[model samples]
Structures are given as structure tokens and as C-alpha cells.
Target: MSTARILIKHGDVRYRLLKVEAASDGSLICLLDKDPQPLKGGIRVETGKLIAEADLEKPVPYGRFSIHTTGEIHRYSGGQRKDTIHIEPLHQLTKAHAVGYFSIPTPERLDTYDASKHTADVVETLEIPTEVSERLTFLLEIGPKALKVATYGIGLSYELYTLVSRSAAARLPEELAASFVEAAALTVFDSRQIQKDEAELRFYQKIYGQGSFVFRENGGAYVALTSVPMARAPTMRVEFDGSELSIETIPFDAQNKPTHKVRFWIRDKGGRNKQHDLREHIRSVVFDARL
Candidate 1:
């Protein structure tokens, strides 16, 4: 018993509805207040493929009948097409729906977008900035395993790299490793926006700069320092020599006075210090200490 307006368009021709009724077979018998004249070639349902065409030689007994869930109706003028009327369920047809349907161009075949081709087009068009492209290319050359270890050091879960890498491999551009690392870092750090602590913010900021990290070779691992200046006592300190990487945490009492301290060390594995192994060692130590 509810009344709704469904506006349908076929090229230059348009249909304004007076009311609609539900048929027994789940089709809609739309009653038109005014029908477009000269709808000669009849009404043909145009989905990805043609469904069926109805003859307009005799006026439709009711108004227009639609059995399709989604598509358009083409009203032809003799041998040539005249209008195209987009059709949707009464429950979905709205002013907004009509606008959105007309705004986007519908493809002839309803298929998934080609992401590889899109990426190739973007690269060929030189859409990415030169500096960003270079950095991403460098990250790609370093590989995903190394990037994952670095992300782990930055307090991301280990599985994050795998998830991002798999998705990027399937749908993203050629800079798969760079994309994975960037996505993982953004996901992890976005949550840190609520952090108000100055020192903690500075720590993450220093480690993540311009979507990349600055690391110096120390002991068996590439090391970075928190190095935030404190008014009373140092909030935290990370020190690395040729032998070990030491992280120290100082806790304060209720009076904001230094009470107790905790510290840990990741020892160098001598000549076995490949970048990945060193990074893994740092991640384990930091993760265990809850730093």
C-alpha cells in the first residue's frame, strides 16, 4: 500500500510512474502515469547480455512489466535504438539511486577490474612521484622478509606482513614489498594517534620517518635510538655498540621520581649477523621486554 516514484530513462525518452504493484512471480507491474510515445521497437531487457524483448504493437495490458533484478530497458525506434530505461527493484529505486546510476558509465560486461593492467597503466603514465618511486623500488629490492622484520621491530604483529604481502601480490602494483611494509606500518601507527605522551610519540616518529626508517649498522643489527630529551630523567635509552644492543626503561613513582629500572640486551651473533637475523634478534628482545 506504500506509494513510491520510479523514474526510468531510455536515452531521450523517460517514464514517470504513478504507482507500482508486486506480481505473484516476484516481478513488478509498474503503472505509468504517462507513457513515452513511439516506443516502436518494443522493450528489451539489457543486462550484460540481452534477456528478452516484448512487442509494443499492442499496448501493454498493465503498464510496464519487469522481471529483472538489475539492468536497463532499451526502447527501440524501428531498426535503431531510441531510449534506455534503467531498472531496479522498487525497494532500491530512489532519487539518490537514480542519480548514482546515471553518474557512472556502466560497462557492457560485468567483470572484475584488472588490477595488473591498472598498475601497469599507472606506472606507464608516471603517476607516482620520482622520490616515492625510488624509495618504494629500494624497499622492493630489500625484499619482504627483511621488511617484515623491520615492521616487527616497530611493534607490528608478525602476521601483518604475511597478510599485506599476500594481498599486494594478488592485487597491488609491482612494488609488492614496499606496499606490504607501507600498509603494515600505516595500520599499526594509525592507532597511535591517541597517544599523548611526548616521548613515546617522538620515539615512533624518529623510527618512522617519511614512511621509512633510518638505521645504522651496529653489533650484528641495524640500530636506531629513541634519544628523546627529558626534563628530569631520560624516559628511555637504546644503546648499541659492536657487541650488543641495550634497551633501558626507567619507571617513576607517584611523585614522578625515578623508582626502579628494567634493562635488556640483544647480543651480537659475531660473523653471523645477516641483516634479517640481526633484525629478528632486535624484534624478539623488544617484544619480550614489552618495549
Candidate 2:
């Protein structure tokens, strides 16, 4: 059986999750080793060390989305997909329901590769309101390949770190904070030329309306990144108004050009959208962002 170890560097402690896909029950065994163990067994968390003999089985979810064909209802399945997300240290603290990677519900789930060329893509318009909606869309074209989230603390399962960076960010001036994230996103796009992970794009669809990405700038649109706590798989749908579902989804490299460049940024929730920057919303009384 093929074994895989998912290692996370959070704060000062290192946490590892081992998975053996071919296992009989689709469960992961915790090992004392920092890597996946060659033998099959289970383990748990000991006071200040690794606990053995516990079997971890997270549901191997099969994420899929429907396609509107002439008559036949189409469905697409996938290799691996997650339908949730977490902000900062909260995930490390409450690791039970934490989200790591996911798929954006798409008809292309069965496709073996990512979309290299596409002029028209579905852009689900999540109405900007203190009001909630049945459906929302998150365009993956606008974001960092991966967030460089800094962490701290000490623990085996949970590398407990202070949420200082996020909290410390609560003090920055709104406008400056917004500009910084925007510039960094643009730089990552221009330099890396990366596209959103196809699986993540599908997973976002599942978590769409759960959160919203708002801007302090007038006339700016929301990207609906995160909002609902303990994100779960989305199993509902909403009827669209005419043609708002399908819009041109452009890559990040075209963000500054005249072409259609999708844009997104991290910001506070609905009422707190005024706290435009991380430092402006996150506090540093506990722990702070290093660099």
C-alpha cells in the first residue's frame, strides 16, 4: 500500500498526519516517527508525546457538481477532495474539523488535468448583503498559491501557536492594509504564474456562501472566501437571475492589464469590513506576526 505523510510546520512544533490509501478501512495510523510508518498500526495523543494504538479515519469524500446538459444529468468524481477551511491557529487548536485542501464542485472533476485555456467560466454572484444567499461563487484566479501563514506554540498534535499575527494586524490603517495584500497577491501572480488548484476551486464551490471577501474601496466586489465557522460540504443550489452565473474568469497575470483579470483580497466580515487590513483587525496582545 502507498503511504503518505502530511507534515505541517506550525509555530515551534511539527505535526504529521500519516495516510495509507490502500488500508482496509481507509483509516490513518498515528506513528511515533515523524514520517509514515512502514508497518500498519494506530496511535493517539499522549500528554506531551505521541500516543500509539489509535486509528484515524477521516471520511474520504467524493466531491462532485452537476452540469446542465440538454437532457442527461452529468456528474464528475475525484481522487481526493476537502470541503472545508480554517483561518489561523484555530485550526491547530481545534484540529478535529480543520480544513486543508478541497475541490471546487465542477463538472470537470473527472478530467485528469487543470484548465489551461478558457475564455468563459461560471462566476456565481453571491449577493453582497448583511443578508445570506443560497449559493455563492469563488473565482480561484485571484489568490496566493498558498498562504505563508506563520505559526508558534508547542504540542505534538497541535503545534499551538499564538494567533498574534492575525490579531496584531487589527491595528494597521485600513487603506494601507488593503493595498499591501493587493500588491502581494499581484506580485505572486506575476512572478509565479500560478492558477488556483483545480481541486481547491471545486472545494471553494462547496464552501462558497459560507464566507465572503469584501473590500473597503467603493464599488469593489466581494470574493466570498471565508465566513461560516467549521466549514462543511455544500449540498444546496440556487436559481440564478438571468446570466450572472457565467462570466469571464481570467488568470492573475492579466490582473493589471486591460484584459479581464479576476481580483480578490482578505478582509474582515460583513459589519467589520471597515477593518480593511490584518493589523487593523488582528490584535497583538497575545502573540504577533514576525515577518
Candidate 3:
């Protein structure tokens, strides 16, 4: 039941796992690791992109870890308290089989609303990643639960983008090239007071779809938009509140090949009174595709 014991089980030979929880808004203030290193800094023992029945036989490196993930979207089994999982060995012990058992408490509440028509809660699930041990305890306070959580939702894509840049590519994996590309495509606006207005969220999402690259409103008081690829460029100038902040982007070509240099720049006045500063923001511009 303790996070430490559960994490050790997370890496068991026959597949260990635990049920971790996350907040709806996605801010994880709880620390999972006693030593608390970023998950991105840890190894990415590539849990294959998708799980197929064929993956069990796949020979992942012995020393390297595999981050196998599984999910369930069930109706809480009509008052069933637990779910059973099976674990089997690979390599020399291919034919041998064993089962590791674990269970999670059903959600305290359940509802039947909207689109899916599935119960709102009461269902729970687990995802297991292979590792030396579950050293990251804080994760339980911040990660997705197995069944109800979705792996492909928009929010997760952004979080993973942060993970890849700050931890995975920049640190252990040294996936510099790929990280650059991801960083270029992923943009995180460091806004102090973000607006949560649905109309505003939809407005910005539309601008992003238009490919205008960058959009700001309310006198730069809000983050209206950013481009997927343009966000990741290496060198660019951002003019905000009469101050210029230079941010770097990863260099990637149209063909996905590495390039010598790439840049993006932003210049928008909050209002007519600030229009005079726009020229100053555009001191110079250069884009060499050949590089």
C-alpha cells in the first residue's frame, strides 16, 4: 500500500504495477521520489509505440527497461472489487507462465453522463513500466490512473513534450535531435495569469489552426496562441511589454533533416499606443533555408 513497496512491484519480473492518481487540472505538487529526479531524466526503455499480442515475444534489451502500458475502460464489473492480470516470462523462459495479482479501489462515486455513456467513475486501471525500482513516489500523486485516463488527449501530448525536452532527450536518452524537433513543435507559454474562458480557449485554438504562428491578446496579458512546429525553433526574438526575450528553437528542415539554423520572431503591440514599438522589435530578420 505504501508508494515505495508499490514501486518495487512496478518492476517485478512478472510485471508489477501500481495505481497512480492525478488532478483534473494537471498540476502535481506532490513529490513521488524521495530523491525526486525528473522522469524525463530517467531512462526511456522504449515501451513499444503500440501493444499487440505479438509484443510479448519481442526481445527488448535485457539491461534496458521496457515501459509497457495497458488500460481498461470497463463498467466497474458491476460491483467487482478487483481485476486480475497475468504475467509471463520472455527469452529462455518463453513458454513458462506466471501471474502477478494486484487490485485498486473502485472510485468512491460513479455517474452516467454524456458522450461515452460509461459510468462517470468507479472504474480504475493501472499502467506498468519496467525499471530498477519505483524510485519515483511522487508520480503516484501526479500521473494517470489506468482505465479512466486517456493516453492520447491533448493535455498529455503537451506534458510529454515537456518531459521529452527537459528530461528524456536533454538528459539520459540524449535524444538531442528528436528532442529538438519536439521542442520546436511543442510550445509552453510561461503565462502568470492564464485565462480559462472557453470562448477564449476556442478562439486561440482556431488561430493555431490557421497557421498564423503566434497570436496574443489583452495587451500581452494572455497567451492567445503558438504554432506546433514554429514553437520549437532555435533562435527567435519575442517582444513583450516593451522587453525583448530571446528564446531558442531546435533546428529541423522541412524534410525532417537537421539544419544549421532556424529562427522565429514575434512582434505584437497590445494596443495603438504601443504600435510605435513594433518597428523597434523588428530590428532585423533572416531565414536561410539552406542552413
Best-fitting candidate, scored by TM-score: 3
Cα lDDT of candidate 1 equals 0.26
Model 2 poorest ten-residue lDDT run: 180-189
TM-scores for every candidate against the unseen true structure: 0.15, 0.15, 0.19
Reference-based lDDT, each prediction: 0.26, 0.22, 0.23
In the range 51-165, model 1's lDDT, one tens digit per residue, is: 2344556443222322222223332222344344443322222221110101101111112223342221111111222232222110111112123422211111111111010
Candidate 3, residues 1-291, lDDT tens digits: the string is 011111222332222222222222122111111121122311222232311112223222111011111111111111221222222111011221111111111111111122243221222223345432212111110122221222311112112111110111122233321211111111112221222222223333432444323332323221212222232323444444445433234344666532212322343333223223233333333433322
- Return whichever of 1 and 3 wins on lDDT: 1
Tell me the tens digit of each residue's lDDT in model 2 across 86-202. Answer: 121121122221111112222121122112431112211111233322121111111121232332211112112111111011222322221111000011111212122222232
In model 2, where do residues sit more than 4 Å from their true spots? 1-197, 209-251, 254-261, 264-274, 277-291
Which candidate, 2 or 3, has the higher lDDT?
3
Question: Model 2's lDDT to the true fold?
Answer: 0.22
TM-score of 2: 0.15
